[model samples]
Target: MDVFEVVADDVRRDLLLALRRGALTAGELARTRSDVSRPAVSRHLRVLREAGVVQSVVDGRRRVYSLRPDALAPLATFLAALTPPAPPVPARALDGLDLEVRRTTRERRTAHGAAQQEESA
Candidate 1:
């Protein structure tokens, strides 16, 4: 099974999340959740191991499991590509309107000053 297929199950995903903190024995992983049986957790662990999503080491009688982060690189890259880019800044339409209004006011003031000077003369 590939990494996607292996992590498709919620129980298996939970098991992976538990292993992310550190290595844990099969029993320890099973105990992390109360809903699933130990055997079921073991089956999920087997799938994860088969997919290269996790690696196991025999520590005495127990099999300790830990996450293999490198195995998830492809999935991470795929997800990153799917994420939408940030929205662009909006155009300042009001700024141009404000400049036009100021120009019109300045023009009217200058015209009024010229008319007053002509009347006085």
Candidate 2:
């Protein structure tokens, strides 16, 4: 299953959110969801595990689940490529303009009512 496909379900997404805090056994994950039964939650977890978004580790008799964040790398990379980068600042945008210096000089002259000596280059 595509990583995106597995996450399309709300339950699977919520399971991922819960797992983000830390690992939890299947029973614990199921308890966190009041709407879904344990069996249903297990199915959702199965999908997530198959999709590579979650991983399970057997601790004695308990099966612990945790999010596999690296699994989202492909999705993130796709999104970053989909969005265009900001246009680069034009190199010569203000090349010939000394408007800032001129404005400051004018403001100083007006506010002080006296000509200010220009700074030496």
TM-score of model 2 vs. true structure: 0.66
CA RMSD, predictions in order: 11.9, 7.7
For candidate 1, the lDDT comes to 0.91
Q: For residues 1-119, write the lDDT of model 1, one tens digit per residue.
A: 88778777899889989988999999999998799999888888899999899999999999999999999998898899999997875668578988999999999999999999999
As for candidate 1, its clashing pairs are none
Best by lDDT: 1
**Candidate 2: C-alpha lDDT:** 0.88
lDDT of 2 at 75: 83
lDDT at position 28, candidate 1: 97
Tell me how far the alpha carbon of residue 25 in candidate 2 is from the true structure, in angstroms, after superposition.
0.9
